[model samples]
Target: MMLAIDFVVVAVIFVAAVGAMSCKNLVSSVLLGGLASLVASYLFLRMGAPDVAMTEAAIGAALTTVIFLVATRRTQEVEE
Candidate 1:
């Protein structure tokens, strides 16, 4: 049911966040972060808070990703 789906979303988000943290490539890490944020938004929506979910989707997924990419541009590329 909804709770089961919520659990899956949380698991996926956890994995994505961990992958984002461990990634060597800044661009991929940024994308994973956005993915994690999107999963979080979905979780929020499932929890019956559409307003909060919308904000998280717009700000966490979109704006935060943009900021991370912009910040990445100012930093040195990740070394293997």
Candidate 2:
């Protein structure tokens, strides 16, 4: 059951990452990237790595989102 849960979590992380990378809009992409990081952190916790999960959640999700938002604010958003 734990393995199954891990698998599902990993799947969600993968989907979220793909969405982030492929998204055209800067805001949507950053949001999805942060979501992927958050999901990945949960997966790390399930795998018995709480410390790594915490770091991932902080750096990958929170810090990264802040940086991306700052960068986005400094430039014009490109349209596809």
Candidate number achieving the greatest lDDT relative to the actual structure: 1
Off by over 4 Å in 2: 77-80
Clashing pairs in 1: none
Tens-digit lDDT track of model 2 for 1-80:
98898888888988988998899987999999899899989988888999999999999999989998987887754521
Residues 1-55 of candidate 1: C-alpha lDDT, one tens digit per residue:
8778878899999999899999998799999999999999988888899999999
The regions of model 1 sitting more than 4 angstroms off are 76-80
Taking all chains together, each candidate's TM-score versus the true structure is 0.86, 0.88
Every candidate's CA RMSD: 3.0, 2.8
Clashing pairs in 2: none
Error of 1 at 41 (Å): 0.4
